[model samples]
Target: MTATSSPLFRPLQLGPLNLPSRIVMAPMTRARSSQPGDVPNALMAQYYAQRASAGLIVTEASQVSRQGQGYSFTPGIYSDAQVEGWRRVTEAVHAEGGRIVLQLWHVGRMSHASFHADGLPVAPSAIAPQAQVWVAGDDGVGRMVDSPVPRALSVPDIAAVVGDFRRAAANAMRAGFDGVEIHGANGYLIDQFLRTTSNQRTDAYTGATLEGRTRFALEVAAAVASEAGAERTGMRLAPFITQRGMDCPEIIPTILHLARQLDATGLAYLHLVEADWADAPQIPESFRAALRQAYQGRLIVAGGYDATRASQVLSDGFADLVAFGRPFIANPDLPRRLAHGLPLAAFDPKALFGGAAQGYSDYAPYEAVAEATA
Candidate 1:
């Protein structure tokens, strides 16, 4: 079958945004932001613009505040400079006729003392994930370091974090983003609160019940939606991955509950990040059916999806869009390559983060590669 006939090539409506195709560029942490302030730069803008052929582009996770930062050189959305820096990125993608959204993030327990002023990361509870975060040395080289136990957030502190999300959503709009995506996946702050094993709080925020465990995530969704307009708001969730010691069975039910609530909020879409690794567990069909029944919004699934699998899911009516992660990273013209069955370029693991244009914007388009070979 030709690319034109594939379901993945069909156009879809995400709230007010009209996507040209079902292929989305998933949000990834490149850690290539300008140093000293964790601000977005022209090089990052160029990188995103080069991949503008995607139907939708979710920007790399940006810290909601300095306190929310975990890795080195990851851009932030809280500061004035950060907002202005992101403006360049949005403008670049917009000029290329691509829609872009800013992903608001707060890394809870997955952080180190160097990234914090109080020398302590914060979470729903004072538990350590034994996770590692990338921190930069004085020489500007990045390295993975062990995460420390985080301080449990107090009632007031929880409210403050919600406020930070609201402010960050507003900042994204000021920075020229078409919308905002709440980063609730990948064992981040919201994910920590959602999983029962990580949140042992007795307060209303983590009130112990399934509803209580999900309160923080729902509150964040509501706050971000209110700030960005529900139609322009989207969120990402990972229900399968057991990272950061968060392998609780109750998480699936918690996600289903959030799904129902999010559907009612009239949000643009819900992004699900599947466990793509070879050894990772596959998402059950029962759970997928349950999610489809619970949520009525646009659904996007990502995780090692090649052309055939993407088409199968879309044709089966299981998902409205398909997001490609590493494929999009290595091939800037990923949509074209997938459509035409062109050979893909491999990504350099070493140049994945905190680097210049060597492995980033320098990835040649298929035509360039063809020309060089010819």
Candidate 2:
């Protein structure tokens, strides 16, 4: 592709914000936060500001409430300190000419009992998965612990969860975020309600129908849209990922149904998290075509996309934007490197999560590398 016609470099309008490129920095969980409050700090601000060249940046998944937390050291948006801490991050990114949104997250059944005061996590049903959640001890060390069976959320409890999401979105706005992305994927609370294996209730939430199963996601989206305008609201969905005993066959139709509902609600975008692992299941062209017919808003597809693959999808006219996860983790100037065919710096897995500057904000840019080598 010629420089003038390169799809990745083209500008696009996403809600009230206009982006300079089609490459979005996907949100990844890097558990480097203040220990006591799980708060965003100046180091996190430096990490985000380093990647300001992307079309947009979505911050890491943040818990809406104390009960929503699943991993140790992950930040939260519900508290006053968190809001103040996030304000520094937003300011840093804006000073670097970047647009950023916060992702609101709730782990639900994926959470461990240690996070809850009553020693029980809540979900759409009382079933437990064979998954593990990260928890921290008094020494501030994170360890993977088995997830226990969760208590079925009462109808009132479900309403309260929805309220938590709404309040989180409002808090995100107050924290100076451009918008909020509802975390409805990765076998979380909303995904638990969406899948049959995780959710086996006989109530309206999990009956023998798709509408009943999808009610929780739609309600959460509506509540978030109510707090943050629908135009500024986005959601991430993984229709193909089948982890934590969530490989349900009925998820395709249910996703289509939710897509149509989100379309009618005027949602800004739908970020689809395709499988990132090697030899992962391929999402058929038929499903992509069907999704296009179902949803009328912008579509962002993530998971293991390089420059050539991103160009192919954008050239095919199915995806509007492409999100790069781990690449952005190491290569802060990812869009520039893709545009110029520069060599990428490999990231060390040891410093991926819950670490200091070694693997977090200390990755030097390409210019520094060339200077040091010269």
Candidate 3:
């Protein structure tokens, strides 16, 4: 497919599965699940089924355990009830002939005790942070004041968390997703372990040597891939982000090396989150080349991408697939809208995070417009 010409309608192979198109719906938290740690609801299922026309759908970052949650009314993939809830979602999506992958997540230090079911949050370092998690109480919604001091993860704790991810993958399969995406980006647990600023511990995990610091993620990739099969597992990373003090001058090489280690894992794809935050460093082309070489499997790039820009990227040959986030929120049938150049309904920026179903699932689709015109 050429850059100037639109080839998005053509089918492509993402790992072992064939995608009808290259467009993917990147996971975004809607915070509308039935409860803080409840299973997904029929409303959530309807939301995904409505957008099933995309080549593939990567669900919102769902915590592997209650302790991993960072917000209220988000879903989990650990418990039996949660698994059953997701089964409903997967059934709906599959009925429409769409493939979906559940994004596995652990918030790490980006959480508060109020949000934590276990009452303490794990971080790479013990240094208190200056951020608060959004929360709600009896009266109404509000951000929790006075952030919880984080507890540095012990070596044993690190092993336990890995087990949690394994369990989550198992649950996801039971729920009948096409695959799972490991959330290693956007200041989450994996990102925290990858950065030196957050991981000040003297353990092998916070390896003083470059290779040591990359060990945790490497092990995680192998573990999840071992259980889920390489084709059924993918990873997401933001190498340039430093929100909770994630620093690494050798960031590019570090991530590439991590991908190299996972080369044997036979994973489906690697999704890179490249946000255009002014303070955040931009990824050089060299890094993309190295990533292309390291990951012999499918590659996906996301964050702040539009059709023209994403089309250029596809032509550049660095990424085989691209995922869209906020666009999917406004246009449930985003691929159709992109193909036909339909006007997009504006998303209520305020209602995006946590809200009722008004903004979440009320957006109309192209067929509705057709019926209206008829």
Candidate 4:
């Protein structure tokens, strides 16, 4: 199908914002925030502004607090400087008529001890993810290091973290974000709390019952929605992701139950992060149908989607929007390129993280590239 007639180019009403297209720019951590304070900067602003053609842009995950950090150079939403820094990004995107939302994050046990003051990451339980996080040394060299056993969060600590999420939502609004997305996916803090394999606690947020296992995630959603307004708040979930020792047989049901609650609360949308790597498990069609039935709000599906697959999914009524990750990194005008069936550019792997502007904002739009080639 041609660009103008494609379903992917259709307009969407996402919450209070009227999106011009159904293409979304999924959140991907580039880890290029200003050092020392882990704050967003002008370079990041330039990077996001370049991709303004997306119907919606979910900014890279920003930790709600210091304890929520997992990798070096990831920005945070807990400080004044960070809020101001994000304002520049929102302003730049707005100038180009792009809509953007901030993704609030807490990495849980997917972290190195170097990020914590007490040398311990906190999770729903003390279990280790058996994964590695990228930590940079004093000399600015980064390497993957094993994640250590985390200290389980206390009841009080859970309340504190929920409060942090609330504050982060308020901070996001102050920073001029069009909305906020709670990062409940990818085996992060909320994901850790939802799965029995990671959350073995016997407390109210235990992994035994579906209600208990979903408590933390629900609380965070309610709190953030309250602060950011339910119409402007969204949450990302990874129901089928099994990496980082997060394989749980009950995760699918747990997510569906949580979706019902979010639906009742009038959440703006639920973003599902499907497995994208080679030979990754395919998300079942039954699950998608069930999710669509359970939640009445808009749904966005991301991972390994090209124009054909994206349009098919939308035609099947499984998802209202499709988010592209790596494609947006290399093609600033990703929506236009996809709509026009233009060839995509490959992103530089070396400069994917902790870099200045070489691979971050140096990518040219198709018009510029065509001009250069000519």
Candidate 5:
């Protein structure tokens, strides 16, 4: 079949943006942001502009505040410099006729003490994710370190973080992004609050009841949607991810409940991050159907999808878009390559994180590689 005829090439109207294709560039942390302030830079802008063929580009998760940060070089949206830095990114993508959104993030317990002033991460409960985050030393060498137990957030603290999300959304608009995506997945702060394994709070946002567990996520979503306009806001969720101490049996139902609430609030899209590791538990097709029924808005699914699986998911009538993470790293023109059934270039594992433009932006398009080979 021709690339144009494939389901992956289908055009989609998500919120106020009209995407040219269903192929989305998923958010991935490359840890290359400018240091000292964790600001987005011209290099980051160039990196994104290289992949402008995507129907949608969700920028790497940018922390909403210093307290939300979990990694060394990841960018933030709270400061004026960070906003201006992101402006360059938005302008570059827009100049290339691409639509982009900033993923508003708060790592919660998925963080290290080095990223915080108090030398402790904060979460819904005082639990450790038992996971490791990439932390870079003064020499700029990054190594994975074990996560320390975090302090439980007070009710007032939860409200403060919600305001951070709200401010991040507004800053995304000022930066000229088409929208903002709440990073509610991958055992992050919002995900921590939704899971039984992480959240042991006794407050209103406790994990004891479905409503209590879901309140923090819902409130953050509401605040972001209110600031960015419900039509221009999307959120990501990962009910199948069990890593980072997020193995909650009740997560499936919890996410379903949240999906219904998100749908009711008129958010633009819901991105699902399925577990991508080999031997990881497969997300049941039954749950996919349930999510489709629960959320009426556009759906985007990421994790280990090639062209065929992506097309199949779209044809199955559940997902409106498919997000590619690692594939886009080496193939800037990934949509064209997928459409034409071209070979994909493998990315360098060594330079995957905490690097300059070598693995980040030095990748050539398939045509360029072909011409060079000739």
Candidate 6:
């Protein structure tokens, strides 16, 4: 592609954020945060700051509360110390001329009994997710174990979760994030409430109605947006196949409903995670078209997108921005790589989880190698 025609290089405006290009660095969980989940260290800051060239950056899913944690060594935004630590990270990114948005999240029943402080894992329903969780137990490190069913939430408890999101948003701003993304995707708490099989409650949050399942998400958006400002707020939704559910008929209407409500909020963007590596069916393409119109703000499409596909989708106007996750992990200069059409480095999947700094900060940028050779 020529310079004038490069979709990766063209500047784009996402809500009030004027991005230098359409390339976005998707949020990825590397489980490399400080131990006991206190804060993100200098190494973490360097990691993000190095990749600041992307048009926009979405930090990994951060636990809004201790109960929101689902994995080991991930960061949190609920505590003062955590916020301070993230402030350093944001400073580093901004110093490098990059903007970042924090992804606020709660793992819900996705957590294990051992991870919770009070030894209690929260969930929308008492039913076990039938999924596996990676825990850190004795004998060095813990492995993937079957996920136990979570306790059903009462009406009052639902209200409390909404408050958690609000406080998390406040903390994100204190930490210097340009924006905040409510984690409504994946098979987490928000997704559990939205899906039918997980949320079988007869309460107002349940039933087959769109208002019932989507009410919780709307509440989160409304609460978080109040703090982050509609132009600085966004959401990530994996309506297709996620650790949540793939083939549900309910996902369509729920997403459509969210787009309609979110459009009115004047949020910056709605990140759609559509993964093709899964074994189940995909989200109907028609929904994307509907969402394209349903949401008036910027739309970011993430997951399994290459340079060619991203450009084509952007040209087709299906998405305003395209986020690359795994590629970003292995290539800090991914935007330049796509622009110059260079081959990408392969990532070590095993090292992607918990690690010191090997896979985390050791990835070399394109310029470093070029300078060395020259």
TM-score of each: 0.99, 0.98, 0.93, 0.99, 0.99, 0.95
* Most accurate candidate by lDDT: 4
Better of 1 and 3 by lDDT: 1
**Candidate 3 vs 6: which has more TM-score:** 6
Candidate 2 displacement at residue 187 in angstroms = 0.5
TM-score of 1: 0.99
lDDT of 4 by residue, 258-286 (tens): 99999999999999999998999988999
lDDT score at residue 252, model 4, on the 0-100 scale: 92
Please give the distance, in angstroms, between residue 18's alpha carbon in candidate 1 and its true position after superposition.
0.8
> How big is the positional error of residue 223 in model 2, measured in Å on the Cα after superposition?
1.0
Per-residue C-alpha lDDT of model 3 across residues 43-126, encoded as one tens digit per residue: 999999989999999999999988898877789998888999999999999999999999999888888777666677898777
Pairs of residues at least 3 apart in sequence or in different chains that clash in candidate 4: none
Candidate 5 segments whose C-alpha is farther than 4 A from its true place: none
Q: Which lDDT tens digits does candidate 2 get at residues 128-238?
A: 877998777788777888999988899999999999999999999998999999999999999889888888888888746888998999999999999889999999999
Which pairs of residues have clashing backbones in candidate 3?
230-266, 230-267
RMSD of 4: 0.7
**Candidate achieving higher TM-score, 2 or 4:** 4
Better of 4 and 6 by TM-score: 4
Q: Model 5 Cα displacement at 330 (Å)?
A: 0.3
RMSD of each: 0.9, 1.0, 2.3, 0.7, 0.8, 1.7
Clashes of each: 0, 0, 2, 0, 0, 1
TM-score for candidate 4, please give it.
0.99
Stretches of candidate 4 above 4 Å error? none
At residue 263, what lDDT does model 1 achieve? 91
